[model samples]
Target: MMASCVFSRWKIPYLASMYFRGVMRIPSKESFLCSRVMIPDIECSSSKTMWGFKQYHDGRPRGPLWRGKKLIGKEALFVVLGMKRFKDEEEKLQKFIKSHVLRLLKMDMIAVLTELERQEEVSLAVMMFKVMQKQDWYKPDVYLYKDLIISLARSKKMDEVMQLWESMRKENLFPDSQTYTEVIRGFLKYGSPADAMNIYEDMKNSPDPPEELPFRILLKGLLPFPLLRNKVKQDFEELFPDQNIYDPPEEIFGLR
Candidate 1:
């Protein structure tokens, strides 16, 4: 009886050890599938994706991948130029500007304005200049006024140039000698010698040293009026005594 009891206890342990060994060596197919489901393969995992070696979680996408074409540089300038088609339609033009131009950054807007001036679209450029003035970032930029004024003068839009000049003066932005020369030439070309003389008077009052080119332009333009010509000539001689005034033949002035 003692031997049977000992054998029974020992047999129980031996059988239990064999069963566990067999279970470990040959796992059930169902358990193997369950283990696969519980611990997923990193390669085939759906919750995470590998961008290079870095793991990215499944979340909202970002960066240039989700964004549209960015309007910058030449593209922004092109959009400003496109507004020229709607120039006569005031409401439509404003709507287009509000939609397109108002969104551009400061430099982009300035570039567009400069390109418009270069293209000689005086009317559109003026409108853009006014738009920029109304912006929160706007400052009293003398060069801005100078460029627009030069464009207007080149286009023979002297009336608009005078308006801009007035606006510039109100802001205490004085123009340079080139601006004076262009305005004087524009006025003379358009048969507005009175206005040309007015600009010359303004130039004389300017704090900047007078440039001889403007005096020469005034002398040439003022030939029809000897009094004005002589006044300009006198100032020229005083400012630059070294330079000689070209006395064109009187036939050139139809005075003889």
Candidate 2:
């Protein structure tokens, strides 16, 4: 039975190709020569399979090539919009870029979505966050949130940065040392040193803060205050007696 089936399958393509050639012969000579050449179904199938295999071997899926192309197009649109230098036009451009990013993410093109993010397009970033929040994709433990927080802080959007931090906390995502440091730095820059100190103290008291957390937090928090600087250093020594202190000479203090 198997041999008979294989023989029948092999004959089918040959019969179909012969039938197609026969039909072509009835056409006028000029028309026949000018008409599209019909390749055998077997050949067409073989070519398609070969192309698919090549794509697969090259680490690309055979389904869609539009994802990368779409990302490039979106990037170009962002650039064109950026050049306008008008607030209303820039806002519109940002909205368009964000919409495209959301569409790509919905289609599960995570790589392209991530690339759009890496471009540091602030409008896109804000829109992405809105989409993430809407879709519940923004997890506190995810490093992306930390990155977004830092970006927002750097952009001097302190309100948004604080809101993101609150959202992270509400999601029960404990901030890492790096996130804490970024927030501390942001607070310091914004004339909220007390807030920075609060974050520093919280980090120092964490159960498993990073090894450098105490020293880094103390030094950063106290560096601007002369009297508190030595006190903070001494406090660090008391807390971690084995740690070394990089104190400047007393002569540098003009005490010589």
Candidate 3:
């Protein structure tokens, strides 16, 4: 008689019909227990599915898990150390890189080149950078050029800095304020005020708004050249009118 009655818990008429069909034939103790328990299990499992194991309504699974930034791999370490080790022996270094560096992945090559730049191994870093440029995957990345230029400028390798700067310009990459400051300071320190002024002109032409730091650096460096210093001072006053220009006494420039 109970089997003859439709199950109210199963809202679907088709599901209720199926349940009644099974119940009508079977009066076993196990069947009676399963019918009661399995209904809750089906309802709860569908509602409480884990996000990680979730599927589309059509039942397709998600794609691959996301990967984070990878660590510097063993190949990168080996290349960095090898470049350092072979620093004095140019021929041997060439051979070493040719033999081992080819196997390195893109990230590994970038890592090794960056490490070399950090160590101020300008020649090695530049060589590896050129190698990276030759790679099929090499795109014109501003940050890569920025780091190398900064390192070269700090080391007073103006020739290399100029070469990299030209290459960067060819690719339409403009240096940031920090880079312009470092490079201008480098030229001034290298006793090339003319070159420093040339960079200042480029900075003036840059599409990005000029920064105060580079102006300050140029003013300080151009102190010996009052004419040049006056040009920068006037511009500084216009761009940052509220800011005070620290005009050190003329004696500092040995003018007094």
What TM-score fits each model?
0.70, 0.52, 0.71
lDDT of 1 by residue, 1-256 (tens): 9999999999999999877854454544444554577644223223233442434333334543123224347556466557778888999998999888888788888877877776678899998889889899999988899889989998999999999999999998789999999999999999999999999999999999999999999999888888889988998999999999998887877976
Show where candidate 3 strays beyond 4 Å: 1-70
The C-alpha RMSD in Å for every predicted model, in order, reads: 19.5, 12.0, 13.3
Candidate number that wins on TM-score, 1 or 2: 1
Backbone clashes counted, model 3 = 0
Higher-scoring candidate on TM-score, 2 or 3 = 3
Model 1 score (lDDT): 0.81
What total of clashing residue pairs does each candidate reach? 0, 0, 0
Q: What shift in Å separates residue 120 of candidate 1 from its native position after superposition?
A: 1.3
lDDT of the candidates, in the order given? 0.81, 0.58, 0.82
Report the C-alpha displacement of residue 35, candidate 2, in angstroms: 29
- Best-fitting candidate, scored by TM-score: 3
State the lDDT of candidate 3 residue by residue for 137-239, as single tens digits: 9999989999999999999999999999999999999989999999999999999999999999999999999999999999888888999999999999999
